[model samples]
Target: MRADAKKNREQVLAAAGIAISEQGVDVSLRDVSRRAGVGLATLLRHYPTREALLEALLHTSFAELTAKAGELETSSSPEEALVSWLRDCTAWTTQYQGVTELMAAAIEDVESALHASCVALRAAGARLLTRAQAAGAARADIDGTDLFALVAALAWVGDQPSLESRADHLFDVVVSAILTCAPVLGDRRPTEEVSS
Candidate 1:
């Protein structure tokens, strides 16, 4: 790519990140172009579709999360690895508005630009989950698919304004449910003390 073209692509991607973070995956291409100070045609030239733009934006994050899962698998106990990775993954999904839906859809569609990255990320989490189950720490009935769905569910619940306050409590509940041998209540964080 020419230097100018590369610079233009970077600007569009940067703008798209800001737009999507603020307005979600559904944010219009026009809005992103406007924010980038580029013409719509230029944006289209760089990212032909919303999925393409999202793939560019999230692929790095997905790789990092996958790497994190690998690190946790080696460094933490089975149960701790699963719980920490779950928490981190769920927290990540909450960053971009409506991204849970995008990730769910992308993972199921091989033609989607994000399919590969999403699958890799899911596999990383699955490794952690399997480790936990093998150690008799996490529930054996659930598999990686179930775990991904649960993460997406948690992200969706956290996305709602009415449930935002309850998200942490809900996370704890989900974590407890995932564990075959639950942690002592006192060992948990996040003020399980929400007098709600």
Candidate 2:
């Protein structure tokens, strides 16, 4: 890309990030263009649609979460890794207002621009889940897709004003239910049978 074009893209993304964070995912693209000091044509040329713009804004975060899953797989016990990463996913989804809903929709819509990123993010969680199950820490009946859904659900709940404080308790309860052998309370390590 030409220097000027790249600059325009960056500006649009930056302005969109602020607008979306402050206003919402539904913030006007025209406003984004105005904030970025770019024309509507240029904004459309770069992002094409609101979903495309959101995808661009969230791509880096999704990629980082995916990479973090890989790192956690090696650094923490399987159960610990899964639990830690789920918390991270929740935080990521709730970064801005209404993002959890957008993510839930995007993950199911193959046609959406954000779908690929959502898929990659879910795949990462699935990898950790697979490892946890294989190690006999997680329930064998559940799959990566199931884990992804649970994460999304928790994020959705977290987004609710009345449920925000209960999110951690809900996470713990759900995660415990998903485990084959319940983890010791407050302990992140896998059980002796699984670890050995």
Candidate 3:
């Protein structure tokens, strides 16, 4: 690709990301082109359709997430690693909207790059979950597929700003239930009264 063409392509991807994050995946290619300050022909040259743009965005996001996961190397116990992963996942989920919708759409009867990325993400997440379980932190009964579903559902539920408090509550509840340790009963604080 020529220098100008490469710049145009980058602009289109950036515009598409913002459009999808703000408007939705259904945003028109013309709007994306305008957002990129490029002609519609140029936008189409890089991404043939809305699905293609969405695929590009999803691919980038998933790749970043997988890379982050791969870099997670805490010397803490399995529970700590699991908690760190969960916190990272939650923060990403809270920041990105419509990600699950795009992912679900990608898994349809369409052949696209997004499918491959999703598969990779699932495999990576499963590997992490397995390690965590082997170290005796997360519940043995839960698998990666379950973790994926839980994260997706939790993201949707916690997307709202007001729901943050509820999200934290839900997180604690789920974490307590999924951990192999003794249940944490409410908030444990040292008693101030001296029995002696």
Candidate 4:
């Protein structure tokens, strides 16, 4: 790419990131162009579609998540690593309004520009989940796709105005359901009873 073209691309990517973070993933391309001090044509020249822009913006984050999974595999307990990564994924999906839905669609459409990034993100989560399952911390029946759906569901709940306050509780409940050794609710067994 030419120097000016590259510069314009970088500006658009930066502006899009800020706009998406503040206004949401659905922010208009015109607004992103204005923020980048470029024309709509220029923005289009760099990223032909909104999904293209989002893919560019999220490329680094996807790469980092993949790298983090590798690092966490050896650095933390399997369950801890899986939980931490799931939280991170939830935060990432919820960072921009509507992003979780966008990613869900992207992951299913090979033609979408964001598909690769979504796949990478799922692969990273899969690594952590595999480790957890191997350690008997997570349920073996749940796969990476299942975990991704759960994260997206959590993010979608967080996006709702009425349910936002309960997102944390919902997250805990969902995670517990996915864990093989999670304590059941109101299970007043010997473990919960005071032994005489």
Q: Highest lDDT among the candidates is held by which one?
A: 1
**Model 4 agreement with the true structure over 1-196: per-residue lDDT tens digits:** 8999999999998899889978889899999999999999999987898888898898888888778888889999888788878878787777788888888999999999988888988998998999899999999998999999999899998888777766777777887888887633333222233359
Q: What TM-score would every model get versus the actual structure?
A: 0.92, 0.84, 0.80, 0.86
lDDT (10s digit) by residue, model 3, range 138-177? 6789887777777776777677655655666677667777
Ranking by lDDT: 1, 2, 4, 3
Pairs in clash, predicted candidate 1: none
Off by over 4 Å in 1: 184-196
Of the two candidates 3 and 4, the one with more favorable lDDT, higher being better, is 4
The alpha-carbon RMSD values of the candidates against the true structure, listed in the order shown, are 2.4, 6.8, 6.1, 6.2
RMSD of candidate 2 to the truth, in angstroms, is: 6.8
Residue 109, candidate 3: C-alpha displacement in angstroms: 4.7
Please give, for residues 117-146, the per-residue lDDT of candidate 1 as tens digits: 999999999999999999999989998889
- Which of 2 and 3 is the better model by TM-score? 2
Better of 1 and 2 by lDDT: 1
lDDT of 4 at 87: 75
Best by TM-score: 1
Off by over 4 Å in 2: 182-196
Q: What digit string (tens of lDDT, one per residue) describes model 2 on residues 50-145?
A: 988999999999999999999999999999899889889987776677787787788889998889988999899999999998998998898878
Q: Looking at candidate 4, what is the lDDT of residue 21?
A: 78
